[model samples]
Target: MPTTIKEKTVLKFEPVHLSDLTKITDLYFSQTGIEKENTNFEQPKLTEEFGFPIYKLVEGNLIIGYSYFTVNSSEEIVFKAIIKPEYSFGDLESRFINQSKQKYLSKKELDRKGMKNSIMRMVDWLNWSR
Candidate 1:
């Protein structure tokens, strides 16, 4: 069975296992209404090599949302969060930020530097309304 998080449960950083990867993939396909494919299977490999972490938002045994991260170095971490299709983006964003902050705070000094750089780069992806 998949690990469960209680309602309003919050987590910072937790190690991810192969089982979690399977659960996450299942959740992703279910929520996105997409079929699973074997193409580009490097994500799981990357996650395993770098000690990526996964977090779940659950109500009882049912996962409501999930997030994961990949840390390439002390200062570089990439995060992805997904929620049920019926949920709002605001909810996912809030949870992601909360979890990220926790992970950042707990990271080693070198890792923190990489994480900051990654975050700064992420800002460039956003469009500013004029």
Candidate 2:
């Protein structure tokens, strides 16, 4: 258990299975009472509607956050993240965007229209990922 929700805890991210939704929801509502009050929140039929991998952020064995993403044929990615209300982990959001950008760049077939800069950008991302 976290000692302080105000401080950001280093979290490890890994791909989550569809069957893990119940566990994720349990962790989320455990931190808040408002969710149980409404009963309006519905589980997104993500995999069936948009095919893509979802990643979960964990502190040891507990899943504290998850990112839902979808990439189109044009390489444009749509992303959304759900985190426990008590915790504020900004790095998770940046990583999700970084993954989206990296995916877009990987599929992008940029011609000589600024090839030098494009290569530089890719190199930078590679170094950052390390």
Candidate 3:
């Protein structure tokens, strides 16, 4: 289990599995209005190439959002929180920043005075599981 946001949501950060391709594609298409060719067929390959981890944000039994990251040296994280259009962006950004700060602290503690690459490597290993 990865870190949770707001003590109510459970964050599952892992590689994209065969079982979740459909749901991931559906959520992406629903949110972005752009359907990829062979979403179910090509997504796995794309995910592998890009080193992306599918993060499912769940509250209780309901999934609230999805976030993904590209595991680069900088660990660039691209996230999209699925919510109603009426949701407040300000509050959402603040919460996201806070959660990210917590993750940063945890990483800092694990690095043991190493450089950022070590931390990035740790994140990559955590995502890739190898």
Candidate 4:
């Protein structure tokens, strides 16, 4: 038997939502193993906030992985995870992150924003670990 082209799967990205919390946490636990104990994989308070863009990869009804991000008081965007080793960001990085659209800053830049935002950085990383 041969599979039809229409049956092939195509992955797409969408914003993470409250409904996806469980699945995302599971993947985080699975991907990070026991390291999940102290992590914020189950907490989405900030990620659930506005401007904190979290995107997940979906193929049909399945979520493959997710890209998690956060914004600090510096107004710089922090990328927490592009989770999954096989997640090839490619050109889709622009779909989710546009340097021209926002004052996107790397983790290094966030370091200079001050210790307060840096602590927020740590917490945000914990939340996005999954």
Task: Tell me how many clashing residue pairs each candidate has.
Answer: 8, 0, 0, 0
Cα lDDT of model 1 by residue, 37-86, tens digit: 55774222111222233566554555656765545555456666676665
Off by over 4 Å in 1: 1-18, 37-51, 71-76, 104-130
Model-by-model lDDT, in order? 0.51, 0.53, 0.43, 0.54
Off by over 4 Å in 2: 1-8, 27-53, 70-77, 100-130
The lDDT leader among the candidates is 4
Compared with the true structure, what per-residue lDDT tens digits does model 3 show for residues 1-130?
Answer: 8986775435433334555545554554555655454646542222322223244544454344444433344544333344323332456634644454455456445333243344355345543531
lDDT of 2 at 93: 70
Top TM-score: which candidate number? Answer: 1
- TM-score per model over all chains: 0.46, 0.44, 0.38, 0.45
What CA RMSD would candidate 2 show?
12.8
The residue-level lDDT of candidate 4 at 123 comes to 49
lDDT of 4 at 16: 73
Q: Could you tell me the TM-score of candidate 4?
A: 0.45
Better of 2 and 4 by lDDT: 4
> Which of 3 and 4 is the better model by TM-score?
4
Task: Please report how far candidate 3 places residue 47 from its true position, in Å.
Answer: 7.9
Supply the global lDDT for candidate 3. 0.43
